[model samples]
Target: MHSFKRVLVTGADGFIGSHLTETLVRAGYNVRAFVYYNSFNSWGWLDQSPEEIKRELDVFAGDIRDPHGVRSAMQGCDAVLHLASLIAIPYSYHSPDTYVDTNIKGTLNVLQAAKELGVAKIVHTSTSEVYGTAQYVPIDERHPLQGQSPYSASKIGADQMALAFYRSFGLPVGIIRPFNTYGPRQSARAVIPTIITQLAQGNRKIKLGAIHPTRDFNYVEDTVEGFISFLESSRSIGEEINIGSNFEISIGDTARLIARLMNVELEIETDEIRLRPEKSEVERLWADNRKARELLNWQPAYGGEKGFEAGLAKTIEWFSNPDNLLNYKANLYNI
Candidate 1:
């Protein structure tokens, strides 16, 4: 595997980004973490990382939407991992233009800068939601794209833009489409965090939307590994690789597994407010992962049951502490 000496990671303040930043650092690569700029000088989750990990990362605060700032961040970096974007589907309902600006336009900016920087590889982040309500089980890279939600639409645009760069300008870009990654430090907006946080606060009953929909969840670490593997593979260039477990479980069953892990028999309640527009709901997402395995030689280390057990243990432990749980708005559903 060819390891880049310096790697730039956009959105390093986020859950998956932070984990990937730390992993890159551990691999002896100098890490430049591009986090959203704030007056507070807060480096998102990087600030919360252990001192060992924090010291290994040089956090650069900037907006991915700005081409100048993105180019500056890419300077001296051998590769780039672009994970910054607006991802909350519910919030996308209220404001979608911002999603387009950040997700689609921001991706264009990254591709342009990477082209100028002569970066070895550009690992672009995509989401499973882009294959909305999968027309077929075990959705592969060739699966049809759907835009049921504005968030998914924006991501689809971004993914298309990334591929366009590769085809038009020969940019060494690979799209890592992760399926429902969940773990510690995840925002409460995600279903896993929403469920785990509710249970952590001693709630016996949980409110959720469209529990019947199934997703293939990959633990954050495994997803990160997929990102790294893609970067190290020559075949991944211009390829859209899926990083997911070849398994599926309904959100209802997922909640049950979490409850079992927590040893709580919580009743699941559906909230109308939480449901998506009648037809917009994505009913099922199962990943084939054959391309990922063939190209990157990566497979999920944790499957559904074990991943749930491990994730719930870590997430519950984090949420149990007031410092973490206090960050959530438990009373209202976060879109």
Candidate 2:
């Protein structure tokens, strides 16, 4: 673990990646942030990070699809957290080709670069979506892979690619499969943000998708800690670890929880425009995090009730500010 002096995080500008990068920098590791190359020169959520934290980052603006750029970014980095991908399930339905290129090919670029650069460790991010609905109570690492949507299919392919590098090329890699992670800086495309933002906007009616489906929500900070824990623990080298809270709640219940926390009585009308195709809905997901507990020595510090409180509080505060809500489309339904 001590062999790594510098860590590189791909997708460092997104929600979870930004949080993990901040945590890594605070942990005294020299951090490199691999954000997407955009003409706007924006850092996404990293732009919203405290100036103190932003000062420590080595920002590299480049696209993950470019092999040259990926390899160059890994040159001096000892470890890499590959989180770059197009992850919206609804958007994937409309643009699956984009998902394949960004999620699958983008991952290949990172894995190959890590192998060529001899990076000590590569933590490839996976999603619980790959498991689809849980066939059993708690979906373990052995759960059969299911592609309920194009986004999940791309992730499954990406996971397989990273594992192949570990087996065929002896590249040190591990897959960190996090379930539904929600917190501050998350976009309105997600359910938590949608509900909070709608309520914060003073709308009595909250627009939402299939509220019947269940999810095991883990706060972003806990998810980031699990990623750090994986780097320090040798047992996770070739493992597929699930970073989850081991608790489940339906979307309808979740909306109610948020409303309760915010002291708002609102109707959760099922917005047909927000719903996915009937077959594409993932029925349920609750993770068996015993592997994460035993191997990473990690268990979620925030449960559903507590996580909801903190997340909703922060989300409400963020959305209450019109400047922030200006970026969100509160009038429309987001899948």
Candidate 3:
């Protein structure tokens, strides 16, 4: 296993990033959390993490888009888990330029910095959205990438950039592509959170878009575990691996499932404003996790028949808390 004492987690303030950061700290690793600089000094979900994790963390606030800032934060770190990217698909449609600058350019900054810093290994985050509407079921690393939306297109560019650095410069990098990771701390813009928050706010009629599309949902813990597996294994260098539950469910069904778990009967409303452009909607995604198993010795523990149901129970518990539910604006359509 590759060993690194000090690791930098870019985007460490976000949902998955915060969980990964906390997990690493608990496992006795020196974690440097590079959060996006904001005047409010917000660390996103990291702010709500246990105080013990916060005490030991070296939090560096900086923008991923700034090469100088990235380099400054990365200095002395052995490895970087770059998860900083603009990911809202609907927002991307309205502002593709911001996605390009943040996702593409921000990725470039990390790659160039890692090369210069001589980092031992870097885990570059990718998304299953890059394989738009999955041409084949059980989408593997070999699946053709389709840029169906601006978000996926920017991620495709970033993924290619990471690969180019690996192939051309021989940078030790692994691309971890996760499918629809959902759990506590996920923003309201996400489907699961939107559904949960709406129910928590006593909305009997849930508003959603493009309910026909199917997704492979992997819990946040499972997704973070995949990153650690790659970080510890040298076999994954210069390769792209998938981290996902090898199962599929339509969006509408997922909403209904969450409702059942929360014990809330609801009407599903199709909000036209919430729907993606018809041509841009991804129809389906089901992960072929064989490569992750073969290469990283990883399989999702939170997947299969009862995995999603169990995960939803945990997520519902989190969102049901008045403290957690208050942070969300359930009445407003997020993004």
Candidate 4:
């Protein structure tokens, strides 16, 4: 195991990043959170983190697309968890150029800086969307990448860049390709949050798209643990490992499950605007996390049907809270 003195988390302001940051701090790791710089000075989800966690953070506000700012953020950090990127698929369709700039170019900035600084470890985040529709069940790292959408394409580029850095300059870089991750602080653009938020608001008709598509949903806590495992293991260097629950469920079933858990009867309405281009829609995803288990000795605490239900129950509890539910505009389409 490689010990890192200080870890820089790009996108530390995001949903998964925020959870990872708090977990790392609780585990006694020095974390420098690199948040997107905005005039509003919003630290994103970090703004809502506990006081103790915030007090322990060394927060730096900067844009990942800016090379100088990215380099500056890496100066004192021995390791980096590069999670900053534009992730919304529908938004990517509307703005492909921004996706290339933020996801690809931004990742390049992180790689270049990590190479120069001789960073001990760097884990770049990848999404299961990169696999597109599963041509085969239980996708492994060896699965062929099919970037059906602009968002997935940009991530594919980023993943290659990270691997290139490792191959060419001998930089210690690893990629953790997580399947669908959901939990508190997740944006309504995600399916689970969309369902939960709409229901919490007492909406009888749930708006969704392509409900037949299956996803391997990993809870935020499980995803965070996967990141930590990758960060600590030297065996993960130059490896692209999957972090996911090895279980699949269609979007329609997931919605029904949520409604059942929430104890509300509802009907799913296919929102035309929510539908992706038929060619761009990924119809299935199931994770084969054997690589993560063997290399990093990691597995999701929330795995399979029962585990998914448990995760969903916890998620529902959080989203059901009036204070949290008020933060979401459930009636509006998020993307």
- Worst 10-residue lDDT window for candidate 2 reads 303-312
In candidate 4 the C-alpha lDDT for residue 281 amounts to: 95
What is the lDDT of every predicted structure here? 0.89, 0.89, 0.93, 0.94
TM-score of each: 0.96, 0.96, 0.98, 0.99
Which parts of model 4 have CA positions greater than 4 angstroms off?
A: none
Candidate 4 lDDT by residue in tens digits, 70-141: 999999899999999999999999999999999999999999998888888999999999999999988998
The TM-score-based order of candidates, best leading, equals 4, 3, 1, 2
Residue pairs in clash, model 3: none
Candidate 4 to native Cα RMSD, angstroms: 0.9
lDDT of 4 at 14: 97
Encode model 3's per-residue lDDT on 1-335: one tens digit a residue.
23897999999999999999999999889999999999999998899999999999999999998999999999999999999998999999889999999999999999999999999999999999999988888898999999999999999999999999999999999899999999999999999999999999889998999898999999999999999998998799989999999999999999989988888897999999999888899999999999999999999888995999998899999999999998899888888
Candidate 2 whole-model C-alpha lDDT, 0 to 1: 0.89
Model 2 residue 41 CA deviation (Å) reads 0.8
How good is model 4 by TM-score? 0.99
- lDDT pick, better of 1 and 3: 3
Candidate No. with top lDDT? 4
